[model samples]
Target: MISPRPSLAKRAFDVAASASALLVLSPVLLLAALAIRLESSGPVFYASWRVGAGYRRFRLFKFRTMYPDADQRLKDLAHLNQYAAEADAPEASGEGCAACAALEEGATCSPVLVGDGGEVICEAEHRRRQNAGPAFFKLQDDPRITRVGRFLRNTSIDELPQLVNILLGDMSLVGNRPLPLYEAEQLTADGDGARWMAPAGLTGLWQVTQRGTGEVSPEERIALDNTYAESHGLGFDLRLIAKTVPALFQSENV
Candidate 1:
């Protein structure tokens, strides 16, 4: 899993390169912040819990691409999505089926979002989670993305702020895209999927590859991600990074 550990050179390169990218990307970050402020009535940066290496938790930073409190609404709407996926999977193949089924079953107030203590934290997190709902894990025609948000996502500006997460050592520049704690928990339940040893990334092998069009099942996505995790090395990471370049510029991810 994750080849036990990255070589010293790879680790050094990841940290050093991430630090360098942060400086180069600062101007773009400022512009993104200003754009968010100008177009939306909410805070410029949005931070949420993401599962990372060793299943450790951290705040994932991104430009505010949706309205505030968008996640909770999804919990309210999970049933509808499940119905649609179930209907479509018989024709489309059973990719996200099991994962979605598992997820939809637990749409209650998740402990990760609930914070360390009581109802107030839980309720507060519920609201924020609801706000982030429209763009949850897998999406098609999400209603929560603001007009500007759509533009930002299309041009990849929406993910730029995640560079900050890279700098804080919460993630890697290339690896698996971090899942929200709930999704990550579900993804790893099938132990030693090669997923347990990896950190969440700004972009990853799965994003560049399996993030292909259509509602990719979480099961398939995890399979691909774990495969990469199990085999990742300098050469493989280099190849994933090379593929990511075009995905970044291509607009259509897959």
Candidate 2:
């Protein structure tokens, strides 16, 4: 069974380590903030809703890596999503199937509908096609990243602000990485939910384990998270933290 609360020792370590890191990294944070402000005309920090341990929602902080209008541009860039198989799949042309075309604009051929690549799909075929992959959105060469943002993402300087999250008890130095609401929502349906049994974290098992492995499937990533959740403790946390430094300079901009 998952513990209802973090171990006292683990919590103490999270507090001390996060506090000390914030103190030591304050100047770096300030410089990063300054760079972001100078490079863009938006807030220096970006806070997006993330689902953490026990499905608690909180704003996850990061240096503003994308432009102010990044959210609005996401639909246009959906084809670039690395996790979406829809990009490679053949798309329906004209008005789509005769059954769907006969239905109203918002109506579906079946009672249950799935939206795949802007088209409403019948439930059975949708499930078959959707079994192609996970729902996580990622891009190999995202055009949204600002000049300074690329540097921050590559070096993971963008994640520095999350120390404040750890200090606030919303996260830990070592645990499963918190997921965006959309991503978390998808995981709630099955054994995949086991990934969230531990505290949310700044650096975790999958980040270190998949460091130079190019890209990991969402299923593989969740399994790593579940592994950490099942075995996490002070000793494991320290070991993972030690592995974190080398993994900081990641090849992927995620």
Candidate 3:
């Protein structure tokens, strides 16, 4: 099925806003780039694959916020992940796996891995889940973050480069936030993958509402994204942009 395109006005706005921001923030962006270089030994910019609107893959740009070997160190730091405890929780039997179970009543629960004959789970499937990270992963005191990284994260200066994404028509200024490849894989497994229909953006309903307070659950975040997908328009987008400024100042945003 062909994916629906974002509205003409929305696309136009994205181009205009992103270009204006990049031009206006040129100095700040330069300073951030320099700081990242001075404090780190890797490339100043960090680009990672992300799933954008309609499940399209695109490279997301950000100021490098972790040590050069952060990806290599992920496995070692898995235990420190805020989502580790929850991901490792005992598999939910009755209600927890209800959605998956409803589709196939006698199917072994994916999380539990047990079956009628003590059958082993598929190795590929198991590894996929393991590598998919979590529904949400945020560390309040992540050790991988550099000194300059912490400041960039706190001030959200690191995200300025995403304006380039917006200008490139890969993202919008306000819409549902895009997901990393792993996170996108997980979201696609959920029945509510329709949330991916919305244009990916730097600021969105969840970011404006949660503002890194970290109280929002994974399900809730997806729901918020779906809501925005269903209801968002130019006016709503403007309102979200207005709210974004204050949300950026929230202490937890760091």
In order, candidate lDDTs are 0.65, 0.81, 0.78
- Candidate 2 lDDT, tens digit per residue, 123-238? 53465465533457888778998999999999999999998998899998888888887778888856788887889988889989897777687768889988988998989988
Q: Which ten contiguous residues of candidate 1 have the minimum total lDDT?
A: 90-99
Each model's Cα RMSD: 10.2, 7.3, 4.9
Between candidates 1 and 2, the one scoring higher on lDDT is: 2
Q: Which of 1 and 3 is ahead in lDDT? A: 3
Clashing pairs in 3: none
TM-score of each: 0.73, 0.82, 0.82
Model 3 C-alpha lDDT per residue in residues 1-254, reported as the tens digit of each score: 32336788888888988898899999999999888888769999999999988899999999999998888987687777676555544343423333344545545444546433675453223533455456666666888899999899888898989999998888888878888887788787555687888889899999999985767767778899888888777789999999999998887752
How accurate locally is residue 123 in candidate 3, as Cα lDDT from 0 to 100? 29
Supply the global lDDT for candidate 3: 0.78
Clashes of each: 16, 0, 0
